[model samples]
Target: MRYLKRHRHVGDPLEAALADTALGCGFARPVQHEVLAGMAAQVPEFAGGRKRALAHAVFTMLGADLAHDDFGPDAFDVDALHPWAAVQVTAAKAVLGRAAGKAPLGAGDLALLASTQRQGIVWEGNFFIHLLVLHALADVPGMQATVDEGLGTALMYQRDDGGMPFVTDTDTWSTVTAGLALHATGAPPPVLHRVARHLLRVQHKDGGWSYTDRAQLPDTDCTTVALEFLHQLDPYAYRGPIRRGLDALLAVRGSDGGFPTYGAGTPSEACMTAAAVNALSTQGHLHHGIIQSALHFLVGSQLADGSFPPGWSRSRLHTLFRAHLAGNHSFRTPPPPIRSMHEQTLSLVRAAQRADGGFGQQDGSPSDAISTSYGLIILTGQADPAPAARATRYLLAQLRPHGGTPSPPDMLGPRPFPYDVPVLADAFALLALGHLSRRIRPCRAAVPGRRHSGSRPVETDRAQHHDAGAAHSTENTT
Candidate 1:
């Protein structure tokens, strides 16, 4: 059965197809990789302490996105790492560590490894890259354990009917992500077989996968994930499905070569285009006419700041807060971001670079770890230490020594409540600290298990600021 039947849409078929496709994708990849590769090349040691940590984050995001495409959302969320996910990360690290026969793995090592499982604050896709990095950084034993656990989870989640549930039957995005997670974690062939059977049947006739199993009503994002997952599972196994999916994806691309979130004449979407390129390339379909056009489209659309605009439209949290306060709580869907031609994508990212040495989420968004980390990954796999250092200082300043991170009053812009500091933020902060520590002598000496020689934990008075929900305690020693 199809995940989202075409009948469910009241909008034009083209609109439904495009919108559905967009939801299945996120921040585009060619842009992300281009930025990351540049940063890595610029930095001599991409995998060294801080750089390594940042690389871990980049990969983590990619892994999380890809795996979520394979598994479902329930498997992991962005704000907090699930205990089960941690076990899987830990297990994968353990097994991999043994494979390498390295020294005993440490907590930082596991954290570093686990960080690769990317679930941003919203549990959006992009957590699998973290798992991949976790495997890369983990000792053989640790890596092996991680892989085993991931595989086991994939097996446990498999349905008797062969298809994986997207959380609980209605989530095609979840199904695709869960499937990818299983593959990325290296599920056994038998399990792969069951999933493959299911994906094929569920795939839309138009060469894509969507909320429902149907024809011409597929989404680009979900299709991208499915294509990549199948490529990883067994390249030749779903060749037909892959071919059709790519074609449908290509059909949806605008004249600018970028794919829009919805129908023809829709604006180009940076994120969707990036994801489309990555998915197509991963599936060995990069040479396709549509794929080539997409690549050119993205390169043309590059921002001067070295970052893409929100593929969907930008949202002002301040505006949202005010609306909520006024009791006009209706959620409005922003229009799709305009897709750019090849040269534009490159120019956009170049333009988006902040003087502070990071990419902002959007032109006016705050320069926090979340945006910086994302920008760094796109511009350079290694996060720029400058922005990271600043963010680190800001994060530390927010810590009350006794409680959660809070937004200072002066920083408010209509939204006065404390912003939620996501798990990814904490992960990024720890990573930045780790990187900065390596550059400074005293800080460098303060690796895990080592006490600060001269500094002592200082006593501070508690403040009355509201907590940012489960304010992730800087509990793990910085």
Candidate 2:
């Protein structure tokens, strides 16, 4: 195994810049101090048990500093993290005198780590998962001995010239979302230009994109996201691809007038429809009959509490925020149905606010950084600033001094499998704070639509049966 002569910090200057941008967005000094203090105070809670303590120690070693206690043998747990993550955490703990003799690392542990690393990456090389594992290994004194060889193998999957993908060789979802966030947070033009170029190059011949470049199926979420990013970054330069993408987006409209995650036959979802409407309105495609049908579907989908059915995220706030954004972008003169749905959604979101100023995943779930961040972003332009302010306070309370926020574990994959990666939490927090500070730029320019020569029937793929009760993993998959 090849090893690097020297160790490097995984968290880069871009991450630090993002954190500073979030801070500059006008969080009060007292609020900042209070959040820092709160993070320190929560260390014990995170380290109270063996499972929790190991996770906490991993975060601290990664620079989040979630715990102050020496993570001794009592804190080590084989099942505390994802199996791959467990391997690295155990190694780090062993090196730190926390697991020596008591929970000593064995040959089996090393074999497992090497095998997992050799499998390339699961879920198509998710960046957060890779980053998490790298951070853990980098914390140990000699754990990076194999990093050079591992990274060399991994880099073989990178695209020739484009923004980094969520996974190797995929420039669809990750590139678009990252572009939006970075553009919003004032990332330089060269970076935005690079992202825009990659997006344009990878846009499927059908005018939309799949989660990964290799996946030919186009989904509403990825299509809309790509459109939104193009709209934000030099709309005119990439108008051709934007037009094709929008047309591809319209092609996926379900019979119910709502958008589905994948093909036409799939069930229409609120979040998918909301994303479509937002993209359409932003790009001046609001006049289409298909969009009106989507609007109706959105209004009809709202529950008594004004929440829409959760789509891709575990949190209702995620759906709510997307719906709200769709409404804002799509309607200059919303009809009664659209207007009523908007009002109800606002009330529901407001009512979901806990006394602690945080929002929960669902109506009765516990407060979390991810949900609270969504709530704050939704309330940013509202008439009542109180709720937004309160949510801001709640999010501030979750902030670690190292500029990362730790959210509760969220589910991923086709089945409900829990995955916890603190870097994701940090990314979302930065995005929400950036939005609140008005630092995030909005996409402009109306994309002109191209007319297809002949009418083609909307094609559908066989739908996978999903458990409604399972938390929808928000990994940008169709």
Candidate 3:
């Protein structure tokens, strides 16, 4: 560690020390430390006459990741870090997008970054997960203003009930989501204080959050998302509450190391576990023995084509409807279709991700932007032209000759939720476009139309729907 200081390799000495401690504790491998050190050496000290503090944070986080791997006797697997490469690719595009004035790395970019679940970010406890990722990668000259704007926009979605009203104020899921987004952008303390209080009061005795504060017993999705939000908002600030909540979560961890949606005996879910890993790892808790086993479980479960199943989301919706009926003696919402054809189909497609880049959500489905974006993130930074090209082709096909889709509904799969297509699908599409823009070098600028940019600023009143049902714990506004 002193060697860096002796050479003045150009970062905070304390950060270097932390990286050293993490590495020496076997958090990362010796070879990775060395490789990272080499990269750090290349990191010019005030060379551009101004330090890339943001880029430095990126390297520091990666360095810490190395240290956390426990200085493995087995060489560091470059493949495992593939996600970072893809992130870097997107980051580069974010830089380009910002420069080209295509779109600031706002909601769409935040969603993409949030999905990464990387470590060492200053979470600020807002709704924008990508903003946290951007904090480390935002090296572009005018990024802070964009951050401010994004924060303001995201904050506007917050509800009096302390949830982000995705389309309507009743959206508990998006409320917590909005809180995380605001935190990601480093929102003001006053805003975070309100969110924190809301989370605290709303948290169930089981240490999780559901549709409303009263919907107690805990669902893995909401629990994981809530825990992640708290961890990011103030890792140190909410340690006790977070740990208590995580304790409840730990009780549900399957012997296989993966987490079950409701109970321990059930088969493990990849997405739940992945979400759990993201939340836990972000809090520097990835070293837990259970997490290591869970990582093994996830890695082992990857299909031949390199994707995991739709575990949590896969529980038949009819079962959830029954559970909700039995628990409340009444149903609050209409019963949705049993199988989420699009979602379920996407799972199969994800499992079949091609080495070339495109992936199908189902075995036979054509590669599309949605699946490709997910696969690319899952693969990290690896170059997979097949998935990339196929996804690009799908997005292009959706275009109405005006460079944007004419109507948001046209791009939507058969699902009752409106936010899915806009936030989830559109975000994926934007990310895919960013990737394709780099890979194919499109002749003209590509901007997704406002037709689907979220029908109402995401903060207004919206219809009520719960595709995931009671068990899935979805909290969409409309």
TM-score against truth, every candidate = 0.36, 0.56, 0.39
Candidate 3 residue-wise lDDT at 70: 20
Residue-by-residue lDDT tens digits, candidate 3, 210-326: 644423336666676677677766778898879877877787788778876655555566556655665565544454566556655555544443334433221121112112112
Order by TM-score, highest first:
2, 3, 1
Pick the winner on TM-score between candidates 2 and 3.
2
Q: How many clashing pairs does model 3 include? A: 51
Summing lDDT over every window of 10 consecutive residues in candidate 1, give the lowest-scoring window.
322-331
Question: Per-prediction count of colliding residue pairs?
Answer: 133, 1, 51
lDDT against true structure, model 2: 0.61
User: Between candidates 1 and 2, which one is better according to TM-score?
Assistant: 2
Worst 10 residues of 3 by lDDT: 409-418
Give the residue spans of candidate 2 off by over 4 A: 1-171, 285-288, 420-423, 439-478
